[model samples]
Target: MELRIGCRRPPEESVPGLLRYRIASKIVKRQPLGGTDDEWVVIEPVYRAIELLEQLHDTPAQEALLIGRFSFNVRFKWFKNWANSEASRRLGLASIPDGPANLRMLRRTLSLEMAYRPGGVLATKIYMKHIAVATTEGCASRPGGAQAELLAEVNQHESERDLHLVLEEFRNYQEGVLPAGPGARSLTEFFAGIDAQLDAASAAAPKTQRNDRDVLNLLTKRAKVLHLGPANYCWFTGPSRALCLKLAGTPTVDRPLIGMCGSARCPQATHHSGHRSVWAEHADRTKIFLGQLGTTRKTERTRLQADHDRALRVIAGIDSAIAIEG
Candidate 1:
C-alpha cells in the first residue's frame, strides 16, 4: 500500500479549513478591531499539518491527510515499526535507520520535492516548535515535574556520547593521524590508553541506558574532560585557570563558555583535526565582516581583525599548536 499527499488541493476543495476555525483563530489573536492582522486567520493544530507537505494552494491547514489526522510523532513511530518489519526487509529497505531525521525524510521522498529548510540543526528545532501549540521561556521546566530529572539523565547520556567522540580523536592521535592536545603529557597518554575499553563497556551496557556510567568513571582521575561542541575540547581542571571564565569575572563558572573563549592564551583548551572546519569558518566570517565594514568603523574593524587572526591561529593549532576557541 502507498500513501500520497497531493501537492495541490483539488480546485473544488480550495479552502481546506472551516470558516469557523479562521474566525475563532482571529478572535484568539486579539487583533485591533478591523486591523490587517485580521486577514489570513491562523491554523494551528495539536501537531503541525503542513510540515511534511509542500502544499501549493489553500489545503485545509488544520486537517492532516496522512494516517487519518494523527500527530506526526505517532505516524513516525508507525512508519519506523513498518520499516523494520519483515515486509520492509523483503522490500529491500531494512537498513534505513529509525532516527528522527527519517520522519520528514520519508515524507519528502514520497512527495518528490525538497523540504523547505533553513540551517540543518536549526530547522530541526523549528519543526519541533512548529508542531507544539505554544512555547514560553518560563515554561521550560517545572519544579514539581520529573522533567528536570529526565533532563539530567538525558545530559548524562549526551555527555557519554560526546566523550566517545573525543576518545575517537585520541585514537587518531595514537595512530599518528593527529597531534596531542593542551594538557600534561601524562594526561594525554592516559587519554590514548583507555578509549577502547570504555567504548566496549559502553556497548555492553543495557540497551535502555545509552552508556555504562561505570566505564565513564575510569577517566575521572586522568581526563578532566569537557566536550565543547563546535569549539573543541577542554581538559578543564579549575575555573581560576580558565581564561574564558576569568574574562567573564564570574568565578562560579568552572568551564569554557565557547562564546567568550580565549583559548589562544588559556592553558586548558585543545584542538584536533575534527575542529578545523568550525575555526576556518569563524576566520572566513570575521574576514567577510571586516571587508564589509565602513572606513569610519575602525574600532569594529580592529576587534574583527583580532577575531580573524585568533581564528587563523586556532586553525593552525588544530594540527599544530592559540587556543582551540572551541
Candidate 2:
C-alpha cells in the first residue's frame, strides 16, 4: 500500500553550505576508479553525480525522501506483520506470537496524513486495540507513561502556583501597599476612589452589579502595573504593551514598556517612590538641553521647554501624592 508522509518544513535548513562544500571538495580530490586521466575524463558524470548528491544532502528534499522511504518500509514490513499476527491471535491461533516489544516505534513511523488515508481506518483500529490490550495487561507501567503523568502533574502545580501569586498581589493591593497612581495618596485611597467611581456609575446604570463587577474585574485581572519609560513611571499599565489584548497578532513579553499608556486614569497605572529618580533625570536632561539651545532653533527650544515643564509637573505630582496621609 502507498503511504504519504507529511513532514513540516523546519524553520531553518538542517545542513550548512560549508558541509556540502567540504564534501564536494573531498570528492573532487579523489582519483577516478580507472586511475588514468583519459579514463577519468570519461567518468566525469560520476563526479557530477556525487556533487549533486552533496547538494541535496541535509536539505528538505532529502528529508522528504527519507521520510517517505521510512514510512513505506514501516507500513509494509512492521505494520503488515503486526496486523497479520493480531488477526491470527483473534482467530485463536496459538502458534501466532506478539509482533514486537514496543508498538510505539511503529506508531511513530506513521505520519499524520497516513492516519487519515483510505486504508488508515484498519491500521488505526488495530493500533487502538493493541493499546487497549497493553493497558489491560499493565504494560502501560513503562517509564514513558510515568513521565507523561509526572509532566501533567507538574503543569497543574505550576498553574496553582501562579494563581496564588495573583492572590498575593491582590492582598497587597487591599493592604494599601501596592502603588496605583499620582492622584491617590495610598493603595487604599486608590481602591476607595475606584469604589466611589463605581458607586456613582452604578447609580446611573440599570445593571449596577454587572457594571461594578466588570470594572472590578478589569482592575484585579486584566490590569498589570509596571514601572517603565524615561520617568520610570510607576503607574505605567495595561496588560503591558506585549500582553495587551487590543494589540493585533501574537503578543511578546519582552517589550519593556507600555507603548501607549493612558496616564493616571489608566486602570493599569500605579505611581510609587521607586519612580522618582526617572522623573528627576528626565527633568534634569530636558533643562540641560533647553539651556544648550539658541534663539535660532526656536521650535526645538519650545518643544524642549514644554517637555521640561511636564517633567517638573510630574515630579511635583508624585511628591504631593506621597506627602498625603491616610
Candidate 3:
C-alpha cells in the first residue's frame, strides 16, 4: 500500500513514501498508533468504494450485485472488528467468518438497516414472478418486466456515457421538463437536457418520480442508510473514530443508530442466552440433509428419521410458543 501510494505522490513531497517510512518506523518500535492510528489519515478509500457501489446499484442487475456485495462486505467488516476487539473476540465472535452466525447476523442487520432490503428482495422476486405469470396469462397483457426493460435501456446508456446525465434526462421527460413536442417526445431528446436546464429539471425529478422510480431507489436509500463506502464501514461507531469525531465537535455517538436485526436467541445477540451458551447449538440441518440422503437405506434412514423427528418437534414447539405469545 505504501509503495503504491509512494508511486502516485509527487517526487518532491513523496507523500506516500514518507507515510510508509513513518509506518515502518512505528512498526519497528511496536507502536499500534503509527499505522492506521495516524490522526491525519483520511477515509478516502472507504468513501470511494461506497460511491462506486451506489453508482452501480442504480441498475437492476447491478443493484442485486451491490446488495449482495454490500451484505458480504459489511459482514466481513463486522467480523474483523469483532476479532480485533477484546470483548467480542473472547466470545468467538469472528470465528468462521462466513458461518451461519455471521450470515444470519448480516441478513438480520441488513433487514433492520433498511426496512427495504428484505422488502426489496421480496419485491424483486414478486415482480419477476408477476412477469412470469403475466406472460402465461395472455399475449396482450404480457408487458413482462417493462420497467426492468426500461431500466436496462437506461443502464446501457449509463454505461456508454454519463449515468447522472441519463438519469436526469429520463427524469425530466417523465416529469414534463419541456413543453410537449409536436410529436410525442423522442426517447433521445427525453434524455438530453442542456447543462443550464439540468439543475432545475433535476430538482423537480425526485418528487415527480417518487412513485415511479424502480427498485434502484430502495437500494440507493439503503446504501445511504448503511454508509457502505467503497473500502470500509465509515458509519460504524468504532472506538478510535468515535473518540476522534467527538473531539472534533461532531455529534456524540450516543444511541443505537441502526437496529438489531437478530433475535435474542441469535448466537451474536448482545443479550445473554437462556441456555449455557448460544454456541452450544447450530442451525439444525438434520432433516434437510437426511431428506437429501438415500432415505431408502434402512439403517441410516432409522437414525436420520429419529434426529429429524426430534428437530421437528423442537421447531414446532418453538413456533407454537411464538404463536401463543403473539
Model 3 local distance difference test score = 0.36
Q: Predictions ranked by TM-score, top down? A: 1, 2, 3
Ranking by lDDT: 1, 2, 3
Taken over the whole model, the C-alpha lDDT of each candidate is 0.54, 0.47, 0.36
Give lDDT tens digits, candidate 1, residues 11-53: 2324675322222111222346542222122234411343344
Sequence-dependent TM-score of model 3: 0.16
Candidate No. with top lDDT: 1
Candidate 2 residue-wise lDDT at 108: 46
Q: What is the TM-score of each candidate against the true structure?
A: 0.47, 0.32, 0.16
Q: What are the RMSDs of all candidates, in order? A: 18.4, 19.2, 29.5
- Stretches off by above 4 angstroms in model 1 are 1-142, 179-217, 220-224, 294-296, 321-326
- Alpha carbon RMSD to native, model 3: 29.5
| Preferred candidate (lDDT higher): 2 or 3 | 2
Q: What is the Cα-based TM-score of model 2?
A: 0.32
Q: Which candidate is the best by TM-score?
A: 1
| Candidate 3 lowest-lDDT run of ten | 267-276
lDDT of 3 by residue, 1-326 (tens): 21111111112334744432121111112435534322112234533444465555556442133333146567677766777788876776664444444654654454333323423433333422323423322322323344455568876664434333334434444454331111112222323433324456558784553332342332232223222111112223232333334444544554222233212221111111121122123224665666677746888878877756644443443333323310
Model 2 lowest lDDT segment of ten:
19-28
Please count the clashing residue pairs in each candidate, in the order shown.
6, 4, 3
